[model samples]
Target: MEIVQVLHMNGGSGDTSYATNSILQKQVITKAKPVVIGSISDLYTTNPSPCLRVADLGCSSGPNTLLVITEIIEAIDEICHQLNHNTPEFQVFLNDLPSNDFNAIFKTLPAFYEQLRKEKGEKFGPCSIMGIPGSFYERLFPTATIDFLHSSYSLQWLSQVPPMVEINKGNIYLARMSPPSVLQAYTDQFRKDFSLFLRLRSNEITPTGRMVLTLLGKKSEGPFGKECYFWELLSKSLNDLVSEGLIEEAKVDSFNLPFYMPSRKEVEAIVCGEGSFYLDGLEIFDINWDGSDDDDNKKFKFDRFISGQKVAKLIRAVTEPLIAYHFGDAVIDVLFNRYMEYVSDHLSKEEGKFVNFVISLKRK
Candidate 1:
């Protein structure tokens, strides 16, 4: 099998720095505990490799990344307790682009180490850890080295620019409808990127190693245009800014979408075609960015930030810089304000959104 490294350059999720960190702190320690438990149980029962040598492939240099990794470790430890198995040694490979903020990871590790001491007491063990900088869709681990692989709120980014988006050429979307060409362009690139991921990992992963991917995706089909609500709402805001002269038209033109979200079919097709992995499980649920409108609910339910079904807000932070770069500072403020308002309006019209999916696969 071929080996390659895929650059995780999307800055994690689309959330701003503060929001991203907060969400990570909340979700990883609490919400994902169960998921990680289930994932490990599935691995032990179904996978040939079971020692918990896990690699977080798209780990950005951020608190949230650490939070997730730490939680996964805790979950595994708890599971082993119930099962009465000797806690297996764990090696956590924190990966990202070469330019990631390694300082953040190093700075926080000591504190995390202290926290682990508090939790585990005399049983404390060094988290066999290292920072590996590179891409995942390309070469990553040594041949047959990794036992379990995981990535969250990543993998939605295309490894390269979505094909056929040349600047000199005409608009990729032939009309306001966003057209079929654009969809196919994004689809083909997603397939190519994902296929490379499977091929690259196939050799290193044990015959039945486990992998989990949690990422954002759209339900719509057509390209980014009037029909897709996300595209329409954002584009209108940008167009409104253009009309007000808040930003230059060239800035908008230069700004291309750095990532693409694939539908379930597109994702399934790509994985199935690879022939090295099989879908062990998949879940797609609704997520809404809008806070619940019920006044009584808002006082407490929304304040704590946990929702029965809420989209991952951290993903929004990762895109804020890109949003500011494209739309200008003034435009971004107006845009996000309008976005929240739009979410409210959308909730009024169609109800809330969701995080949508959690997919697990096992190598075959």
Candidate 2:
């Protein structure tokens, strides 16, 4: 499948849309706020520009779309206030695949601008936001033009599915049952894609510019871990449909996600090998599959059914476009219903969590 054409989160503001189902992503951005603030503050203090050019890569539409931007702007404003400097005019670029819901983001801009004006008063931003449609795997901006770059919950998506993963039959992603060759294919693909990403961004960012990236990652040195259990459950849900004759086994075999969760060791190796950026900081954290769950509350009870529904909706919003494109729309409801049940049962047995890596980079 052509990932550039096919890959995008579910668009619009409907119930099933990513706009409505992205609380998990919001939580992720919130968790990474300190790192983001620190990076932006450092970038602005060291090299204050009259016009600040910022690009948010893989910026899928939703409340989270502007969350990072808002933080960056606020950080800069705070610095300007403390230093008694003029607030730089902001030029913000929101980037995603051509298929993303740019219109949804566009519709919300007026309110975003108005809120900025009200909060910061008249002499503030004069910020301008625009949508850039294409893949970040390729260059998106002129050389040494961007002052700051940020991405969240997006880099794990590979440019395309690795070749010869047909051997990864009965699974949509890396799993315990996957063969050795399948694992190697995924590892090699991530290394290649991530290395290229660093090279491209290094060209676009100034020498002193900073980047903060957050994406799914694994704690183990090896690829196979509890992280694969999430995809394994989804694969089982599809197999359940195959058993009932609702989906073709061949179709399931042919389908594999264009995604890979890299380990911190792998990420560091690639960043070093790419030879374009200095790895300033790297952090790993975990979030429950159900975004709303309060992990800190000792008295909190685990509700399998509710957690199952929440996870199913979250996955569905992100994957439905691709799944519907490949399997036809008729199977969406049935597939997710089975997925919900499987996730619910799995949660009852064991709580599942997503491992995330947030890294800070600077151009060499």
Candidate 3:
């Protein structure tokens, strides 16, 4: 499958659209806020450029897209106020694949600009926002043009599915049941893609520039871990359809996700081997599948069915395009319904959590 052409969140503002179902992503960004603020503040205070150029790579459309930019601008504004420095103009670039909902983001610009004017006053950042469409694995900007960079919940997506991953039959991603060859194929692909990513960004960002990246990661050092459980449930759901004769078994066998959740060790090795950036800070944290469920009160009544539906919607919004492209649209509703059931059963047995890695880097 052509990932660049087909890979995009469900667009528009409808119920199943990414714009509406992205609270999980929004929670991730909020959790990583301090890292983002520190990175932006440090970069600007150290360099003090008159016009700061920033890019949000893999910035899929919706409120979350601008949410990152607003946070960065506000951080910079606060630092400038404290330092008695004039607020610098901003050149913000929101980048994602060509198929992403750039129009959805574009339509919100007027209100965003108005909000900035009202909050920061007239003299505040004439921040110019533009949409750049392409793959981050390839160079998207000129040399030394960007001063700061940010990407959240995006890098786990490989540039393309590994060529040999068809061997990973029955399961979509790296699962405990996958063969050793499938595991190696996935690991090799992630190393290649991530190394190229760092190299490309090293070229685009200034020497003094810094980057803050957050993505799904795994707690274990091995290829298969708890992180694979999410995809496994989806696979089971598809297999249930297969049992019902809705989808062909061979189709499930051939299908594999273009995603890999790296371990912290894997990430550090790639950054060190790439030889371009200094890893200033790296952290691994856990978030529940239901973004809104933060409390640990045992006395509180937790509705597993409701939480399962919520999680299913979030995954469906992100993966429906790819699934539809692969298996046709007829299977979407049934597939997710079964998926919700599986997830709900799993939650009833035990809570599920996603591991996330947030890293701060500077060009060496």
Question: Could you say which candidate leads in lDDT?
Answer: 3
37 Cα displacement, candidate 1 (Å): 2.3
Per-residue C-alpha lDDT of model 2 across residues 1-364, encoded as one tens digit per residue: 8899989999988989998999999988999999999989988998899999999999999888999999999889999999999899999999999999999899999999999999999999689999999899999999999989999988999999998734788999988888889889999989999999999999999888999999999898876889768889899999998999999999999899999999888999999999898999998889889786464434676678988999999999999989999999999999999999999999889879998899999888
Report lDDT per candidate. 0.60, 0.91, 0.92
Model 2 regions lying over 4 Å from their true place: 293-300
Q: What would the per-residue lDDT of candidate 1 be over residues 64-83, giving only the tens digit for each residue?
A: 66766776677667766887
Model 1 poorest ten-residue lDDT run: 1-10
Q: State how far residue 36 of model 1 sits from its true place (Å).
A: 3.5
Error of 1 at 347 (Å): 4.3
Clashing pairs in 3: none
- Candidate 3 ranges beyond 4 A from true positions: 296-300
Supply the global lDDT for candidate 3. Answer: 0.92
Write down the TM-score of every candidate. Answer: 0.78, 0.98, 0.98
